[model samples]
Target: MSTDGASVHFSELVNRNRRTLARLEGSRSLLLRRRDGEDLVLTTASRAEQDRTVVSAATRMLLAMARREPGSMELLLDLLPDAFPWVRFLPETDLHAFAVELVDTMRAADSVGNNASVAQLLVEWQHTAEVHSDPELLAALTTDHGEDYGPVPDPREVA
Candidate 1:
């Protein structure tokens, strides 16, 4: 009938279908997707389905900011490779998605100039990432929080 009504219907359909979707690589966002160029489901979750960790409010805010202004995503990406060294804890397959979300959170937190809050979240995120991803996290813990990382292995060692 009306465009608003049509839009509502489309959104509902997308949310419905999305729920049934396996989240592909097992990661999902509260984003709607289209199948055959139409809405397919109604959203049930507030954040992306992730493995190894829960998405925090800070992270969600970051994703929202990225959706609102794609350029903002760059700000989040800049701090990534170094900030979340715990990334070594995550399974290699899941690191990409985790990094993307982690950086997004950083950008959003940074946007409001809440230096204290942002710093806190960054520290926590790093802690979690390091705990879950890095195999050496235990060593660091046992070694009394020393962070003297050595070097990355050659690509061949990754397998």
Candidate 2:
């Protein structure tokens, strides 16, 4: 076969394989051959999968930044309010924990295939903060461990 004909045949084979794989596995991968004997595998992610990956990466990066730069925690809280309503009311010191919670909530939403649920959860947190003037109450709701971090041993209690 001519070079041009061979190229067209290869292209058609690849496209057909990709569609078949997607139908059978819910994902498609392409194997690329290299001259040096190394092959590369490329895979496709669905929109929801992409969003979940991005959010997880961003949350981890933001948490690292806040830990390394104390000022960044405040900056993150300031910036997140517009997109994440709960951030506006959470104390700067609670940013790390709040961010952790937010990421978990986002992951849960992603699992349920509800992209809009994140926004709804943030708004609900905002309203709860507004209505509850007590700092302890808010902290309980926002922190990793609801009202208690862990059960305090009876001996650790101060008289």
Q: What's the TM-score of each model vs. the native?
A: 0.27, 0.34
Q: Model 2, stretches more than 4 Å misplaced?
A: 1-45, 85-124, 130-159
Over 1-159, each residue of candidate 2 has an lDDT whose tens digit, in order, gives: 111111222333466866544543443444544455555444456744775688667655655665677687567566666776655555655555666566566666656766577677666667755745578776666578535567776985867
Q: Candidate 1 — worst ten consecutive residues by lDDT sum?
A: 1-10
Tens-place lDDT digits, model 1, residues 1-159: 112122233345446655434442243322344545744433224432322124345555656765667666555454555665555555655455655655555565555634455567556766666666555765665575556578978998798
Per-model C-alpha lDDT, please?
0.51, 0.57
Q: Which of the numbered candidates is closest to the native, going by highest lDDT? A: 2
Count clashing pairs, candidate 2.
0
**Model 2 quality (TM-score):** 0.34
